[model samples]
Target: MQVLMRPWGAMHYRIDGPEDGLPVVFANSLGTDLRLWDAVLPLLPGIRAIRYDKRGHGLSDSGGPVSIADLAEDAAALIEATGGPAVFVGLSIGGMIGQALAARRPELLRALVLSNTAPRMGAPEIWAARIAAVRAGGVASIADAVMERWFAPPFRTTPALHPWRNMLARCDAQGYIAACEAIAAADLTEAAASLRLPALVIAGDQDGSSPPDLVRGTADLIPGADFHVIPGAGHLPCVETPAAWAALLAPFLQDHAR
Candidate 1:
């Protein structure tokens, strides 16, 4: 239950593994917090894994307005605080933050992993409507739809779905809206293309939000980034099938170990 007091607000974060191990910073998706990587972290032991809730998500304090770059700054501060120059793993909007951070402060990262995300998500109109809907009806209004996009059919019928659904519905309305706003305004195509570091891009075959082709396209943007697809999963493969996700990630982390 560690909290980093930033200039804007307080950020909830945690560090796992030994102090001298390689650092791996994880940033979760739009409606999820640091716990998003809980299952995956245990599988990849012996590394200093850092996870944090972005402003407007989880236990982090909400602010007025923000962009992808602003969110990246928060990540940068976290990495620096933890003795940085580490590998960065991000999903959904978190991936966008990774791109912005790589472009803005390349020295803070040793490698980059973009999971189930793209340079730009939906158009402004789509996010605008989502924001309006949440403002009018709260996060529960969109929880079902989000759940549909988040998990594949099989996982949807299991008991695991309920907790994720509740996590989405319980998200802070203003915080969720603020994240939507950031995603709407973000366009990191060029930043992703210009990245010059060890990188890996992954996607779920059934990811409705960021499909395999879209995520593969982001991989194409990077010079030599390897792209792989996780079967029987949706947007959050690390959640739906953590073992398979870790199987892919473990090697990448080994290859880029500092």
Candidate 2:
């Protein structure tokens, strides 16, 4: 575990594996923090894995409104703070941030593995309503709402994933709301064409939040980006189908590692 002081605030992060190995960074989903990668981390070996929370989420100090660029900058800062230019693995808003970073600061990225997110997160009005609800009612109001979109229908019926469902609902509402604003305002369609990084776009077959078609659209925009769909998974593929996600990512990272 590590705490990094950025221009905005102190960002809490976790680092694993030998320092000499290839670096792999993870940018998590909106409501959840670095802890969300627990299942996937063990699957990735021979790499220094990095995971951190966005400002206002998790143990990181809360700050004012944040932009998608701010999220990218924070990611770059984390890289510089811990030996960067890593193969980036991102989910949801994290994927959006990774797109921006890959476009604007290509030098900071070795490769990109994006899950359950798109280049330009369209449908802003829906996100606007979601932000309003989180800000007004706090994260608790959206716990079940997130669960519906985040996991497969069968996972919801399992007792093991229940605690995580409640935890998602209990996430910091302000952080979720602020991150929601970042997603609503971001547009990276033009940037996708310029990306030369080795990239993978993986989507969940049953994910309503970021459906397979949306990920396909993202793949079409980014040059040479590979696309895959995980069976029986939703938005949170790392939790619902960690093994499949790990299998898809391992070779991609191994092929790109310096």
Candidate 3:
């Protein structure tokens, strides 16, 4: 584990595989940390993988006010720390940050994998309300609310997923609210459209958090972006269906790595 402190965020990351291998940076969703990639990492091969906690989450320090661009700067700083440009793979808030990074730091990205997220996540009022609730009552207040949106009906009721749902409840409230603020203020539709990097957008068929239409709209806005939807799973598709997520992502990364 290596920790890199940048102006905007602190990156606590794990680097694996040979230094010479194509580098791939994995950014986790809001509220969760790099541990979110635990299931997907072993299924992946052929690249140097880097998974990190964003500012305000997990082991990383909660930096100052966070914006989508601020998050992007964190990614850029992480790339510089990793020795140079690398492929960026992100989910939810992480995906929005990826779009911003690719737009502002094109020289630092070889490719992108945007999963379970949107360039411009609509409904700011909803975000604001959620943020306010978390600030007032903590993550426990928002946990069940989030779970309903993250997992589909069947998985929501599954006994196996209960612990995961409880884990969601334990996330830091400040981190959750800050991330929501970042997402609410974000509108990267034009930024994504302007990117020249090869990109892939993976959505979940049953995800209400960042539904298929939201992701499709983002892909439609971005020129020449590849889009795929994971069947049956919801927002955390990578967790629920790791193999399927890897199958969609691995080839895109392989094709784009230079």
Q: Which stretches of candidate 2 lie over 4 Å from their true place?
A: none
Candidate 1 wrongly placed segments (more than 4 Å) = none
Q: Which candidate achieves the best TM-score against the true structure?
A: 1
Per-residue C-alpha lDDT of model 2 across residues 1-258, encoded as one tens digit per residue: 579998778899998889888899989887887878888888988889888888888789776689989889888888888887788889999999889889888998899988999877758999988888877887888788878888888998999677786667767777777888888888888877778889999999989798999988988887798999999999989989999999999999889986
Evaluated against the true structure, the overall lDDT of model 2 is 0.86
Ranking by lDDT: 1, 2, 3
> What's the TM-score of each model vs. the native?
0.99, 0.97, 0.95
- Residue 256 lDDT in candidate 3: 76
Candidate ranking under TM-score, highest first, comes to 1, 2, 3
Q: What does the lDDT come to for candidate 3?
A: 0.84
Task: Tell me the tens digit of each residue's lDDT in model 1 across 1-258.
Answer: 988988888999999999988899999999998889988988998889999999888999997688899999999999989898999999999999999999999999999999999999988999999999999999999999999899999999999899889888988999999899999999999999999999999999999899999999999999999999999989999999999999999999998885
The reply for model 3, stretches above 4 Å from the true place, is none
Clash pairs detected, candidate 1: none
| Candidate 3 per-residue C-alpha lDDT over 50-75 given as tens digits, one digit per residue, 9 for 90 to 100 | 88888878878777578988888888
